[model samples]
Target: MNEIVRIDNLSFRYMQGLDNALEKVNLGFEKGAVIGITGPAGAGKSTLLSCINGVIPHYMNGDLQGHVLVNNQEVANLTFGQLAPIVGTVFQDVDFQTVSITVEEEVAFGPENIAIDPAEIENRIIHALESTHITTLRRRAISTLSGGQKQRVAIAAVLSTLPDLLLLDEPTSELDPIGTQEVFEAIFELNKTLGMTVIIVSQKVENLIDCDRIIVLSDGKVAFDGQPRKVFMRSQRLAEVGIAIPEVTAFIIALHKKLGQPISTERLPLSIGEAQTTLENILRQYGVLS
Candidate 1:
């Protein structure tokens, strides 16, 4: 019942373009849920986030139909100043959102712009730096941070606003594996401790294995939307559309096939750790070993 964002009959087209960037999309997100959005290029994933965060009709030149609501308030009805506290977005390019030279300053920028009390702004900056595990880097110049660190800094900057929903646009796409892990750890940790709802767009399927839900868009429409397991159960369907289910999920499916029975999607593992536990249990259940 605590839905944070809702989209109703939404559709949009660039002012000069011929096709709708999004088409009649209807979706809802619950508070504290970590949902992953995935699909091919130009599939409206970013556009969807833009709508919820008031970037579509308010800032961008687009023909938008329908509406997006954040915390039951229409996004388009709210001013940018009003929406900043309800939703925060981190785009693929961290530089766009990060303006200050130092990590601490970057984190403080959002609250400062909103004219929060100085004491409250300082407290929010401290909380954000700690939440993102970048306390040691607080005074470090933004130019010296690695891609991962920079992304974390950007996230902390957004967190400073204490938004209810966080919109991530491929924040980890350009990071190395370790960097990717670092960013996800910070994000999921914040999601756990702060009870923040997150909507992340990524083509990195495996990383999304832990998401509560995966929504796949194809050609500006909702082609698949369900729990991770339920959506990945359509592995073949995903592959046909140039999307690969996680390698771990594929291995589990193959193992089930080798046993002459299909494993229930409910029992499949989306991650390597889960796969190990599942396989061990299966061997023990079949009396293969102690």
Candidate 2:
């Protein structure tokens, strides 16, 4: 997979800050991968997202150091107008992004601003609504939608621009369990079927466990970057940094600590089904279960 994003020795300090919000952060994201960024509050997760979309130095007042490259183009050098088509961002607050009264208008807003051909704009809106599973809601008013539906519309709005990389900040922060699942299902489907690279900034560990990669940030730096299975294993360190481990992994860790079962690290269980299967196999081996 080609590298879609690259952050090299990146650091930034806001106008009122004494220290950098992001400190010497070095990382790269692969194309067509769903990557999760999570950490405690003040971990610079949002700052990292801003850099990818060329907002750090261009739109926001900040002291920036090092570089951020999207699709091999340096962020600092790209104008917001130039970057808009390359990177699409959905902020944490869905309400803040809601501009149009109707879902169809909302989804078409971005593409229209870019002066895309009228025929192409129509196609983009249709594809975006379908991709985010919001086709039925297109004729409805945005204010009448549920929290999850609003989020889906926000994502669809960004998707209409046909950006190569999508960056979301706490998309499900205000959603219920079912609502969260619906939004994530749409996101993962896009990544899997459409080959769109997605980077989501969230605090929900369970929601991120199945991503192709999970990056844990601390004190404005990357403390862990790898597959979800490996990152979840550092329960102690993650807890110290104020990042909670996924419940399933936490339960398995406790079992290993208490029983000395020597659980294999090859494929640590991240979900209930995986945990159940692993536990049953272990019990069977010990003659405790058939």
Candidate 3:
């Protein structure tokens, strides 16, 4: 896979702060991969996302150092107009990304602003709404939608721009369990079907179960970056940094301790079905279950 985004020796400090929000960060994301960014509060996950979208030095005043490259172009040097085509960001709060009242208008807003051909705008709007599974809500008022519906609409709005990379900040933070699942399902489809590079900053570990890799941040630096299973295996290290593994992984860990089993933590499962299968096999072998 080609590198869709890169961060090299990146550092940023807010106007009121002396310490950098990000420090010497280095990372790369592959095209068509879903990468999850997680850490304790104020660990610079949001800052890093902003850097990728060129919002830090351009929209917000701050001291910034290092390079953020989207599609091999430096983000700091790119104008908002220039970055719009390559990177689209859906904020944690959907309200911030909303511009029009109706769902169709909101999805068409970005393409319209860029002066895309009217026919192309219609096609993009239809494609985005269909991609996000919000086609039925095209003419509905944005205010009438639920939080999850609003989130889907927000994502659809960004997709309408046909960005190569999508950045989501706590995309499911305001959602219920079902809502979260709906959003994740939509995200999975987007990544698998559209081959869009996805970078998501989220605290919800379960939502990241399907991510190709999970990058854990701490003190504005890269602490862990690898497969989700590998990262979840370090439950202790993650806890020390105020991050939690998926519920199923946590359950297996506790079961292993209670049953005195020597299960490999490194092989911890991410989903409930996997955990159940593993547990059943172990229990049957030990004659605990027939």
Each prediction's whole-model lDDT (CA):
0.88, 0.88, 0.88
Clashes of 3: 0
Off by over 4 Å in 3: none
* Cα error, candidate 2, residue 244 (Å): 1.4
TM-score of each: 0.93, 0.93, 0.93
What TM-score quantifies how close candidate 1 is to the native fold?
Answer: 0.93
For candidate 1, lDDT tens digit of each residue in 1-290?
88999899999999987999999999999999999999988888888988988887888987889879998999888999899877899987788777888988889898888889999999998888876678999999999988788988888899888788999999877678876887788789888998989999998788788799999998889999999999999999998877999898898888888988778878888898988988898798899969
Q: Going through the candidates in order, what is the number of backbone clashes in each? A: 0, 0, 0
Which segments of candidate 2 are over 4 A away from where they belong? Answer: none
Point out the higher-scoring one by TM-score: 1 or 3.
3
Once superposed on the true structure, which residue ranges of model 1 sit more than 4 Å away at CA?
Answer: 285-287
Give residue 134's error in model 3 in angstroms: 3.1
Candidate 1 total steric clashes: 0
- Candidate 2, residues 189-241: lDDT per residue as tens digits? 77787798999999888989779999999999999999998888888889999
